[model samples]
Target: MTTRIDDTALLIARALIAALFVAGAVQKAVDPGAAQGLLAGLGLPQVLVWPALVFNALAALALLIGVAVRPVAFALAGYCAATSFFHLIPSDPWQMSIFVKNWAIAGGCLALAVAGAGRYVVTRQRKL
Candidate 1:
């Protein structure tokens, strides 16, 4: 069915988006000092680094496993937008590219939130 195929496609897209965050979380966990330094440079407190790492990991897992998709996607969208403005801007070409990429990712998250993980999600919220 066309709907079934579309749902599968959405599942794949969710997984791919989650993968990027998971990989980034792994990198941050592996080299937390670097993450801390970067966060500190952004004028964030050092204590917040670990929480951010944990949030990233949890959000990525939720996205990948198709649980609470809409809220998780929305939250990640906010994160992406916030980071793009706070951390990625006012930098070199590489960071500019990342800024643009974050916005694009945020846009995808917004779309996913609206789409509600299609039919591939663990649980579906029904209309009242």
Candidate 2:
């Protein structure tokens, strides 16, 4: 049925999104100093580094496991929005390109939040 196919597509999309989050989180976790520097470059306060690292890791884990996916998606979307706001503004064309990339990712996260992870998510089965 069409619904089943859509579910499969959503599952794949969710997995991909999870992978992105996990990779980013892992990178930050493995190199806190580097992550902090990156955040600082984005104009974020130093106090934000640890929280961002922890939240990113936690959010990625939750997404990977499909647990509380709606909220996770919402949070991720918010995170992306905040990043876009801070880092995506007042940049040259080259930097603007990277900012646009974050916009696209933020759009995807917003879609996930709105769609509630589709039928393939554990949250749908009340597993989380």
Candidate 3:
């Protein structure tokens, strides 16, 4: 049995999920050295940080606005899974935990993609 409050719950969940990217973007903007170094360490171009930062910010806004939830959720799920590779460090429990967390976040995004944004979306799309 679902109530109107279920939509509210979805809204809150979307906001919370989006907040993860928001925080990451802000952290990168404030101190991009870490992200840049991470990229460099992985034999990737450090300049990728700019695009990643932009993507995170845009995705955060899209999620907050409840726009293109399915697409955004799917994209974020992939992003989460890809980034988890950086945290694959069994020697460091913290990094391993972060890796697990990233996978967990990806799972949440997958759920959102499957379930959709519900009635709290800012722009409603025609349901097929």
- Most lDDT-accurate candidate: 3
Q: What value does the lDDT take at residue 66 in candidate 1?
A: 88
lDDT of each: 0.84, 0.73, 0.92
lDDT of 1 by residue, 1-128 (tens): 34988899889989988998998789878888876776788888877767878888999889887899999999999989987864565658877888899999999999989887777767666899
Q: Write the per-residue lDDT of candidate 2 for residues 45-120, one digit (tens) a residue.
A: 6667678767877887777666787888888887877776545545477657757777787888888777765666
What's model 2's lDDT at 101? 74
RMSD of each: 3.9, 3.6, 3.3
Could you arrange the candidates by TM-score from highest to lowest?
3, 1, 2
Q: Please give, for residues 1-128, the per-residue lDDT of candidate 3 as tens digits.
A: 44679888888989999999999999999999999988988999999999999999999899899899999999999999999998898999999999999999999999989878878777656899
TM per candidate comes to: 0.86, 0.77, 0.92
Query: Clashes in model 1: which pairs?
Result: none
Model 1 compared with the native: what TM-score? 0.86
